[model samples]
Target: MVVENHVPLQRLNTFGIAARAMRLARVRSDADVLALVRHPDWRWQDTFILGGGSNIVLTGDVRALVLKVEIPGRRLVHEDARGWLVEAGAGERWHDFVAWTLQQGWPGLENLALIPGTVGAAPVQNIGAYGVELQDRFHSLDAIDLETGAPLTLRHEHCAFGYRDSVFKHERPHAGGMGLKGRALITRVRFWLPKRWRVELGYHDLQRKVAETGITEPSPQQVFDWVCQIRRAKLPDPAVLGNAGSFFKNPTVTPEQCADIIGRDPHVVHYPMPDGSVKLAAGWLIDACGWKGKTVGRAGVYEKQALVLVNLGGPTNPCTGGEVMTLARLIQTSVYERFGIRLEPEPVVVG
Candidate 1:
C-alpha cells in the first residue's frame, strides 16, 4: 500500500488530462486492495477506483482516496471444444491483454484492438469496435463491495450490460439498489474467446482497407494490426497530447427520429441499434456541425476523428470532462438544430 499525496494523474490516464489526487494509493494485489478498503479513512466515506484512466475526465483535484489498481497476473484458465477461457486481473492493460490472447492464438478481441484502459473497464462500457463488443466474450467478474467488505460475483447477465453502459456505469454511477453505486470495484474479469477466428469486415474503413489491399483471407492478427494502424493514424497519442478516447457516445435515435435525420441529412452515418433504434455517429454529426477541428480553450475535437477530444495545452487538472462537455453541448445543439438528434457522452465523470 503505497500512498502518495497530491500526485499528478496525467500519466495514469490515456487522456493525459492533468488531474490531481489528494491521496493516490497503488494496490499491487487483492490483499493490498482489501487492506486499503479496510482503511477507516475510505471505508465509510467517498473514494475512487481507477484503472488505466482511459475512459474518464477529471474536472479538478479529486479529494477522495484514489486507488490505482495495480493488481496483476493473467492466465488462460481453460481451452476446450467451445473456446479459451481467459481470466485477467482488473488492472491489466486492455491492449496488452488483447495482444497476449492473440499471441496465444485465441481470437475474438482482435476487433477491439488498441483500445486504451484496463481489462476491468472494458465490461463497464461493454467496449465495442467495428462489429464486436465485450459482451461477445464476457463470462463473469469478481467485484468487491466498498461498503460491507464483501465480494460479489457478477455473471454476464447480472451486469445488465448495454451499449456503453452496465450496472456499474448507469445505476451505479449515482448509487444503486444496494447502496452500492461506484462502490463495487471489479477485481478480475473472465473472458471467453473463441479458439477459432472471427474477421469482422463490417466496419467501412476496414472493408475499404481490405479492398484496397486485396486482403481476402484476413487472419485475426492481420485484422488486429490493421485496426491498430487505423486507430493509431486517427487517434492522438495520449503519451503526447492529452485526451480521452471518445468524448461522446454515438446517440441512439428512434426509428422516426432516424428517418427524419436521414431524410434531412443524406450523409448521416447510422448503425441500427440492437433495439431496432438507430445509433448515429456522434463524430459524423459533430463533423457535420463544423466542430471536428474546433477548439475550446486547450480542449478541442480531434481534427481527423471527430469523436476524440484532445487537450491543446492547459493547466494540470481534471475538469477535462467539462471542456469535452462544452464541445458535446455544441454538437448536441447543432445536431438538434439540424436533425433533432441529441449527442451523449460515454466517459464516467467524477465531478
Candidate 2:
C-alpha cells in the first residue's frame, strides 16, 4: 500500500473537476487492503473506494480516506462445453477487459464495449448498454467487508441487480438484503460467457450499423467496433472535453403516465420495456427543454448529446461538481414541470 497526502484529483476523474483527497491509498492486492484496514492508525477511518473515476462527481476536497483500487490481473479460470468462466482483478479498465475477452474468444461482453471505468465498479452500478446489462453475464464477485475485514463471495442473485442499481449502491445493511453500499470493497469479478453467442442488434444504433454495413452475421469484434463507432460519434472524449457519460438515468413510468405525457407532448421519444413500464429518452427530454449546447456557469450540456454534462472550462478553470449539480437541478425542474417526470443523476456525487 502506498499512501499519499493531499492528492490532486483533477485528472483522476473524467469530469476533470479540481479537487483533492486529504489522504489517498493505492492498494495493489488484497493483502494491501487488509493491511490498511488492520492498521491501528487507519482501521476506523471513513473510506471511499475509487476505481477509474469515471462515474463520480467530486464536489470539493474529500475528507474520507480514499482507497484507490489498483489490483491487476486477468485469466481464464475455467472452460467447458457449456461456457467459459473468466476472472479479472478489480482495477482493470472496463473497456480494455471487454476487448481482451473478445480476443480470447469470449463474445458475450461486446455490447458493452467502450464504456469507461474499472472492472470493479461495473457491478456497483450494474452497468449496461445496447440491451446488455452486467447481470446478464455476471457469475460472481469477491469483495471484502470494511467493517469486519472478512472476505465475501456473492453470486448473481445476491447482487439484487436492477436498472443501473445493485445492493452495493445502497447504504443500509438490511437483515435479509444485500445492501452492501459502503460496507464492502470488491476485489475481483468473474463472468460466465456462454459458448453460443447471439448478436444483440435490438438497439436502434446496432440495427443501423447492421443495415448500413450489410453484415447480418457480424462477429463479436465487428459488433464491438460498431458500438465504439456509435458511442464515439455521440459522446465526447473525456481527454478532450471533460464529462461523465449520460449524466441522468432514463426515468421509467407506468403506461398511464406515459399516455398522459404523450397527450401533452406528441413528439416524445420513448421505448416500451419487456415489462409494462415505458423508458423515456432523457437526452431527448433535455434537448426538448432547450438545454443542449447551453451552459450554466462552467458546466454545460454536451452539444452532441444532451444526456452528457461537460466541464466547459477545461483543466485550467474546470467546472466544479457544484456547477454540474446546479445545472442538473435546473434541467430536472424544467423537465418535471413540462413532462411531469423527474430525472435522477447516474453518477455518484461526493466531497
Per-residue CA lDDT of model 1 for 13-82, tens digit only, reads: 7766767898888877777767777877666657787888988777777888888887787998888998
**lDDT (0-100) at residue 339 of candidate 1?**
66
Question: Estimated TM-score per prediction?
Answer: 0.93, 0.98
List the global CA lDDT of all models: 0.81, 0.93
Q: What would you estimate as the lDDT of candidate 2?
A: 0.93
Give the backbone clash total of model 2: 0
Residue 51, model 1: lDDT of 88
Q: Please name the candidate that would achieve the greatest TM-score relative to the true structure.
A: 2
Instruction: Mark the 10 consecutive residues where model 2 has the least summed lDDT.
Output: 172-181
